[model samples]
Target: MGSRDLHQGATMTAMSGATIHQVAKAAGVSPSTVSNFLNGRPGRMLPETRARVEEAIRHLGYRPNRAARQLRTGRVQVVGLVVPSVANPFWGAFALHLEGAALAAGYHVLLCNSARDPERERAYIDELWADGIRGVVLCSSLPSLDHVLPLVEQGLNLVAFDRTAQAGDPSRMVNISVDNVIGAQLATRHLLELGHRRIAFVSGALRSVNRRERFRGFRDALENAGLSPDDAIVWSGAADEPYGDLDVAGLGRRAAADLMRGDDPPTAIVAINDMCALGVSAGVRDAGLRVGQDVSVVGFDDIVLADLAAPPLTTVRQPMADMAAAAFTHLRECVESDEPATGRSLLMRPELVVRGSTGPVPPPR
Candidate 1:
């Protein structure tokens, strides 16, 4: 039959509830062949047969009954992905890459935004576990993993992203992240090399593991330069706020304005991320100061917009695609393996990308 005729047939069959047997008959193949296609075991099947089955499925809009499949196989073809906030483009980009990897492996991603709240993270994970999702990629980077320890102990295949493995973490847990400390150090050292002595570190909160590490790296860089770490300015007015993710850019802008108003304003600012860096750049203009000339600004996470900024931000680059692929690969291995889970941490290196937003310490203003 022609494609249109097959689609019409499928519509009628779907209205009456299509089944594997019906699909097999429509494809002129045995039900076992259809089963093999659904189960991802069609490698041995002839190319034409596989194509026929795929076409039949597409024309029929056939969706496998996941409930029945799970009942029989005790597994679901879906994985959970929990991110801090999609407001930050960094997290959104990471999610896109991660989803791409998941789709290629024949799995779907269920994304949740937790706003860096531990309780919310635990609740979402609980829901995912209850829904038969055995694997998850959590990107909250919370300082402690205690909230979800119970679920992890119960055999949830979890891959923590943007957070380093801690001593108290479960033995089987997988942690994947760019080396935040080194990344921050690279950003700060670049500023120091430009002869910027009065530097400031700007971020929302020093609560999360990654943020804390970045702060430490900033301090380490300052100390390495023979400058007292305490001499560097640190702005985190929103430290007590729970919804900092929603207004990261605003926070950076505010920090910039307040710092520039001071008598000993910093010659350079190291923002938490590119979003905040963009905000800082705006704030610099608000204070009637040129970004690259008056006060250099450096940001972490070389997001797409970093290059599009008015002055083109100089920032640290995370290998987002590679990290996403690694996270998915590790999670899938844990999900499909029959062996006992073993804990592992993957720390990817980051590179510094210089752009127009930073420059030599503006000849002491």
Candidate 2:
């Protein structure tokens, strides 16, 4: 094209909003060279030259079309994240951080929620592979790693968090997680220190490694303190304790009439998560028991509800932000590494935050 034509074309493209071509020109480099630089692939280019392209793309606010970018560079610049049950606030926030990190690095993200279903997890895994993507960050694991093993064999980069054991290879995957066992132990130890005996453990699906670890810590505290954890004291739930409370509320004037009359009542309860603990709190109120006065509670995952609950929850605080950042860092390494390096798992220590929800155990009746 002539100078005038080149000028007109540039104007038209600019008017439409800057894309890869504009992004490249603004950086004074060939479009292919810019694509290589952005994708973190080696090209016969200098560091200073690459920096110019990167700076220009940032200054111009350029976003490349996903399709064209993929065609020019083998990398789709898409990080596929498979999370378990976005309904959980923990998973939801983690997904947001993963996407944000990818975006800041001038890439896009494809998020898929497995909803704790193995079948759906397999399906999403198959589809992301078929779609020809850069890599994946698998948040949770299923009973079978058949789908995942193949991805590794096919030379697809993969990293996992929270469920690294199920990934089948520590050297091939990175993990970002809380020290679940320690976190739980910390929460449980606090209650033991407060002299709570006959404490009940409320847990979610036992399949969750994190929850299981939390339960283990709770059990250890009871054992370490010379208290036998009555197997019956543990409640594995799907309906949640709150639903039992809802049923109680439905009883209207009769609510609290049958409080703990069914069997021996504990002075405090330990919950696997904030949601389950919230349910336990509801049950406590529905039964006319004064939480933190008549009974105390401890929860894990110090979610927002941990602080907002009527009796603010004393719980374990997983370093969600730091974990998120670590997950992103691990993922970027997987994305940018020339070839797979031996994978590493990193666990952040959890902190126990004592709030109004827990207190010294009430005197024996």
Candidate 3:
């Protein structure tokens, strides 16, 4: 029922399979007018004409063929964003913020969940490119962006958050992110101040740059404190472990329980994200140990779930709202203007929020 599908024969009436022409003829307007009305464009049409088109389409139950209209306009007024794991609160919350900003900027967002699967991510990228979207945002990315580099190089208006193709590759991508290094350092130092000498850094996986950066911050903090940085205490080994990243939050929930139950475990743990902290908290409870009371824990990306846990989790708050706003701003600049954002590298600092999860370390158990 749109530009390309103006003819009654090319469209369908979901319920009765009627065409646009059928609806238009019954409504007393040409197929083109009916198509425009259904496509949400009524700028020049007369008030009476617009009403007639609407009534006819309604009476005949004509539904516009979005696929057909998308061809004529060369745009769907919709932007697409591909991110890893919506089940993770960080990406999930970012999705909401992005959709909000898009709508305020007179565009709609089409969300795609890659579930951290590389193949699925590549497929979504190709699909969005084919869909004629105005702009794109990639949250989780690969180590090599050579494949998609051409698109951005050709001025495709792409903004990336979280991760990008490779280090030092800003030729085609506008990168924006929270200062994960600072946040991680804050968490690590907090544990150190609490007198926990043997602190473990936990992550679901180390494949992501965010996690890697957090580890970097953790190491930096140790070195700053004149303490030897120990990689053996880092849980990046979870990369090969099934559901490693997903278990971070779950680990936070039971930290004390598991540690107390075990004969050997760190007195304090720093989770990659708040979700991982929850899992740690769970281990605390399962072992009947008190977090902050016996074992302290900290997490990153202070999501709402972090505050909702039994003892609101102590975490490093990544300014997700500001990060999302920056993504859209950079993309809009890239799209509406010819030049790139003259200044790149927007880094929002992470704030450490202490709650029930962290506390002074208890003597060795």
Candidate 3 lDDT, 20-118, residue by residue in tens: 788778878888877777655887699988888778766655665566667876656677888766778888899999988888997788888765566
Worst 10 residues of 1 by lDDT: 1-10
- Cα lDDT tens digits, model 1, 162-223, are 99988888876888999999999999999999999999999887778888888889999999
Query: lDDT scores for all predictions?
Result: 0.88, 0.70, 0.73
Model 3 lDDT on a 0 to 1 scale: 0.73
Question: Can you give the TM-score per candidate against the true fold?
Answer: 0.89, 0.78, 0.77
For model 2 the local lDDT of residue 358 reads 91
Winner on lDDT (1 vs 3): 1
- Residue pairs in steric clash, candidate 2? none
Per lDDT, the best of the predicted structures is 1
Q: Which stretches of candidate 3 lie over 4 Å from their true place?
A: 1-69, 164-170, 237-239, 242-247, 250-264
Encode model 2's per-residue lDDT on 1-365: one tens digit a residue.
11343454466665556777777888898888877876658455888897898887887667767776557556666778887656667677777877777778866778887755666767887788878774787766443456567666776677667653544563566656788888878988898898877677765456656667777888888888887776326665544332222221222112122334446687778876776676677778777787788878787777876799888989888877777767766666776774665566677888999999899988877
